[model samples]
Target chain A: MTRPVTSTDVARRAGVSQSAVSRAFSQGASIAPETRRKVLEAAAELNYRPNRIPAIMLSGRSRMVGVVVGGLSNPFYASTLECLATSLRAAGLQILLVHVDDALTLDSALDQLLSYRVDAVVTALAIGSQRAARMLSDLAIPVICFNSRLTGPWISTVVSNNHAAGLTAAQVFESCGVTRPAWLAGPVRNAASRARGHGFIAGVRANSARWPDGVLEMRGDDSYESGYDAIRRLLARGERPDGLFSSNDLMACGAMDALRQHGSLNCPDNVVMMGYDNIPQAGWHAYGLTSFDQQVDCLVDAATQLLDAALGPDGGPVSRTRVVDARLVTRRSTARLI
Target chain B: MTRPVTSTDVARRAGVSQSAVSRAFSQGASIAPETRRKVLEAAAELNYRPNRIPAIMLSGRSRMVGVVVGGLSNPFYASTLECLATSLRAAGLQILLVHVDDALTLDSALDQLLSYRVDAVVTALAIGSQRAARMLSDLAIPVICFNSRLTGPWISTVVSNNHAAGLTAAQVFESCGVTRPAWLAGPVRNAASRARGHGFIAGVRANSARWPDGVLEMRGDDSYESGYDAIRRLLARGERPDGLFSSNDLMACGAMDALRQHGSLNCPDNVVMMGYDNIPQAGWHAYGLTSFDQQVDCLVDAATQLLDAALGPDGGPVSRTRVVDARLVTRRSTARLI
Candidate 1:
């Protein structure tokens, strides 16, 4: 059997350097039109398709990753996605982004991504089923869950320290001498929210007998309107909660808008509000919302390391769940009372 | 030479149905662990690997597309990206997403995407230079320029009726009988911004002899802060334009917030404000912003059709530019003076 044509063969036929032939095939590379045309002609004659990534290269480095993410509406996820894409590209890997509209379809999304033979799969969407986790392991695919982590160590995960965030919010309110505090919660089913809420209750219980009852709880669907309506309902109860700890920043902003519009509350003065996910908008002069920064870079870094180890030789696919620390940003929303 | 092993061979060897064999390789596909392990063992015995797609298959039916987008911070692009991903999946194609932080790096971004051998590319970032356009066409790859059309027919494009959108805003102000209409423009270098601004000026010229001088124009970076600061600067001049048309919804929201906080101007009654890109916040009761809906689904459909034709057998890789109409959404932000 005859040997297959290669870039070097095409280079010889085109009478150009091997690098020039590679450059002609590369999208952003700048080779003269004449040289590129000659390379293309030579490649066509030799049936030398540049796109065919070799299997040896594929097993070692397909240079592609699948990232399934939901929560595009949240700036935090959007920003985090950008950071991951940049970081992945810096390491010569391209990203395939699959936005899971619903959690039910997450399995299928992963399936589709796997068909692409990606080097790794990172999901920002919550996937909790053991069966799904096992399937991924069966395929020996490297998997990393971002932001929200699962109960099992079947998949390596890197998440923000949501428990600490909740604790910080409770402490902020207690230190400000707030008599009544409310938890403006995000999607209750969300693990991140559950962690934050759990920590908040624990911290509050530690400080005052006001424990559970003192914690007025209201739910928001991570939308501005949800938070706005929730705050309006709480305020209509005659007296407003002296302190508010929102599960996410958007909800906190909406709550703040509601307070200023209806209760004429100018945070920290009339009410103190602490939010999770210190999105850039929270820093706006109008909001000045005190919140927590998830430290996306650190999370991305952890996930990157996990991926490297999983794909490395002698890899047992060591399982791990790493929780990076989060920092509380004190802004006007939760200013301490004088 | 022997025939290559196929899924049917794997299925026959494992005593499983063809569909089951396929499912084992697919994501989101459900199969019993015992059955899956059996199929895998059989495949290992046969040395069968379904993931190694040949170069011919890679170039022809890999069914993957690359989408490089910027301005995820802008909800419009974020929403557009989601729509494209869903539509592409419906057509059995996967998406490779690249977040271009700066327009300057777009060349390299496109290069990396091409290395994946995507069937096509969709870029929302403006491509102004002739060289960039030539490079894409030189690859003999199909490209769909989303949201903004370039100067040449080398690439297919779909854009919103930005100029008409400008005209609609101009007419809205005139119908409201505003004496001084101000334009809150986005980045001057952005083609979309230029199209909208040019259309607005022309629209005003058609309605009144006072033409140019009767209108006010201020620049914004299409951010909430830019709009807020621009409005504040206009207010500090001790003058208020009766009509305001912001290039984007975020900027428009910012402008409205600034007006209410500093200028004490009630929208529609004292000053009517119109925004482009009808983001979800525009419909919220707090803003009730009147804006233009770019009809993202329609745009996606147009680009999809273009891709189909370019890849079709009878298709000449035809290159055409299509602009769809955008409808005005009238809300409280632009109430008629009564």
Candidate 2:
């Protein structure tokens, strides 16, 4: 059998230096047309493809964008990927989706992205890991965080305002004449969760005197099952509040199920409820949920903007932060409350 | 603004040749430890990043897999992506997700994937165009079709037995004493839809005089609205079938809604209905849809196997087609019929 052809063989056949052969395959190279033709002919004959893994040695545009998200199962992240891909096509770029479930070890994933030499990196559902932030800063590549809590004067972030959105949910419940309210909080330690929880509590405190000292801060798991299980546990205690606020729509949907099953926990009639991240299911008549719209368009636009900045002409002194606003969409679930 | 530091500048600062600087950073290259140290230190001081994009010209392992799919609004593809990611992770690969809607040309998408030199292309919901198949064939990079049809043995494919699964549904209906059946199919000219339709008709005709002309084929979009509309249109004709088989669960759910509203379609009593793609919602009591499982593990395994062949040591001449088996999932939708 003939041995596999190598770049050296193509170089010899084309009568060009090894470096010239490499440059010929690299995008945006200034190789002469005749020389390029000769190199191409030789490569075709030998079945020699310029390997992309060693792209560090060449200079050209990869036309690949590295998209980093925290979760694939989360409907928010899933929908974000859908929108990002659409926007990317409009911009004539392709998305390389990377899921970093464990936020702390983003370095390895980043390294893989770097190896591919993608034009930029966009993160959705990023939980402000210091190591990840530092690595991204050091990489000096364009990085955009969608719905992440890395907002500052320097880093670019495209996320709905969790703080304000949470506040709006609380005000909606209060406006419905609810004297006593309970909170179904997300992970207590998560930055976005903390901000949202604080905002809601602040709103309820400002309007109502029946707010409990220890807001039923059941730590959320950001899943439908977790929401259902948590709410069931809370309802089992026999002290149900007049209103409830869930940090995410999944949990709220789960809470809806739990409320329906527990005869004592009536909703719309007795206890009004609201949630965040108005996912697709929120509009379903069965759920008829009221939640915060993370502004898919604004979020996607902000993410693309960060990517643009990351790949800007200068690629220097990147934007510190960008915050997109979230809006409250009241459906039947919260219609009575608002 | 000051000029951005280049690799040439790093070389000058490190007192080394440009090639030596390159060698120092190149993985697995024979470079002295001290030399590599000097190059790194100089690069940091000058804020220089080696032209990473050039690696696209270097080696075949871009470590990037292109995953093309359509209809993110559908939950099945969304869930498939989740599993595909895990499978790719185990192989130490990352995914580049490309979402193409109906209006766009898949060939254009393939062109984009080609330009990025993606290691392999895996399409979840679309088929590779003849032109793309030829292009990839000439390029020697495999284009693995996941849950699609393959006309020739040259291309690698991982797909479920839609035809057999359809037959399974018919058999269930027959055992349940159904004499007449109507089909709710996907869009016209879809290969998967056609296969299922043909198989269901064949199964119904076997061992029975029922359905002399086979089940009535009604075309609809693979969505809830289409399903609802198709069933409504069928019912308005003043003729009804004893059994219903929707090509997918979304449409089946919609059909159930229409039946409920019209007061003519009740599962196990008025008519027995079934769907395919066993989506999560099929289990809901509101819509207890019996369906067929696509066997996600087998589908993923087949794709992985094809990729292995394409990138294997033998350079791939033996493996091409793999068909995963589908199973009939008995649920309340068909329980009374059975």
Candidate 3:
């Protein structure tokens, strides 16, 4: 076996002090250009990978970030986690992914996170109740939620304007000359779901007729079937809504299936469906569901910024809300151009 | 601010040597019951966390496992990762998740994994391409792939019995008296896809003209649209198959959508559609796609065992293959009640 190269080996080969070798690798550490070049050459020849010990001793920077995420079953969360992981890697920090199952609460997950003493935690919409946010706050840990608003005095939240996003979807339908609208809502208890439902109602009222008394509101897990069931129940009620708005794309996809099953749901026809969080599946030719493209890049940027701020010199600002904008992505599902 | 506790404080409070305090925390380290109790009491009072320093010193045994997963878009991989993360956590190991994007080759991801020097590397199914298996042979790092099979001396792979799984699906169809069967296959490049296809064909032949002229095969990415397109194309062909077998639940779902679109596919009379990979969507009432369960628990166990073998005292056997059995799950998509 080849001998493992050490700092001493590099110093002896470079004919410089060990401190000079260390300075060449350390960020912002000053060393003469010639000396740095010599150290680099020696280190390269011996294949010396710098042990993380010096970095730990000098600055206590492990350069490793912890990302705790749940609900991988949902494509929206899965995509967000992918983007977040990629962004963190590009920033030269390794991601320690903690996938908490449905049975495990956010508190128990945080216990594991605390054990690692992660530099920061990016909780991408953890499962269960809102109480987890308070637990995260009490830990005095920096947490940045994705699309989940944290109403506390110490944590930062990164989210899209769900209410405005929903309103925008409805307005698009209204501009397209649709008055009767149905909401294929997620669990109505969820904050984002309620906000969007409220906004959609507001948008519809501003246009015409206040959607009458037959504004079908469906509730289920944010799934395609829930959307489908919502539409089915509405159709059974003998109220053919001209416009359908789903809070998320999964439900919208389900609604699309329901439309297909009912037959002849097309442009200027039976009904038009739109959804939020323009998930990747929305682009498929099968669905091509019109939806809102939540500003994923901006959401991720906000999360990264929050993590950075928590590690900043001023002891970090807490209890801040960052909202990224969303735009309507028209598709065949809603029969909206562009 | 509260003063941070150190080992010296624990030793002073416990009235024992610093080494005794260290032994109290270290697993299998010799320490008397009385002294250990005293050290624990002192640690609790001082709020001192142990093993962080020595764990740093032995960073070589950091117990952090790196997982390079491809296809976050697929829910199966997501579930597998969720299980692996939970299992690893339970076993006192940290997970370093590296999401390898579509464009990045497995070799590049493996290189990145090498840089981290993880105790082990776990790759999801998509990563066991021929080129990647060859790279694994040379890397000398502990690698275990889930639901992926790569034939090589140094590599370890855990896969469900695709051939038998396919045969089981066919037999189930045969029992339902379905003669004309069509196969909605996944991409030709994927090993699991091909294996399942081969097994189904074998079963058809074994049944002796139960499915005469073999099952029609359509190839595309393992997605809903692909399944839809495959079935649509198959329907347009000369022989309209009475039964459809989608290689995955997503594609089966698409096939179901397409079948329903044509308004000819019914449970007993027209067609019976079955899919592989019992993804969560398959269970929903909308699709209820009949599919084969991958026996994820068994798959995870094989993966965990392989990882242990690869990193254990013996440094793994020269060559090993672990194949987990699978079961067929009957559902509404193939509502034939076989």
DockQ of each: 0.41, 0.29, 0.34
- Expressed as tens digits, the lDDT of each residue in A115-207 for candidate 3 is 564566776663245566665665455677755544464577777788898788777776666667778777744667778888887777776
- Tens digits of per-residue lDDT for model 3 on B240-270? 7777777788888777767777776654357
Worst 10 residues of 3 chain A by lDDT: A102-111
Q: Is candidate 2 or candidate 3 better by DockQ?
A: 3
Docking class of 3: acceptable
By TM-score, the best candidate is 1
lDDT tens string, model 2, B1-338? 44557778989999988887888767668888888899888976775666644454455466568878666566677777777777886786768787777421244565456445667777665454665555556555666776555423335777779899889888888877777788888886466777888889889878457657677779888887788889889899976877899988888888887787788568767788898878766765456688888877778888887887777675543337788888778887777743
The TM-scores, one per candidate, come to 0.86, 0.78, 0.80
Clashes in model 1: which pairs? Answer: A111-B27
Task: State candidate 1's DockQ.
Answer: 0.41
Judged by lDDT, which candidate is best? 1
Q: Could you give the candidate ranking by lDDT, starting with the highest?
A: 1, 3, 2
The lowest-lDDT stretch of 10 consecutive residues in candidate 1 chain B is: B103-112
Candidate 3 interface RMSD to the true structure? 3.2
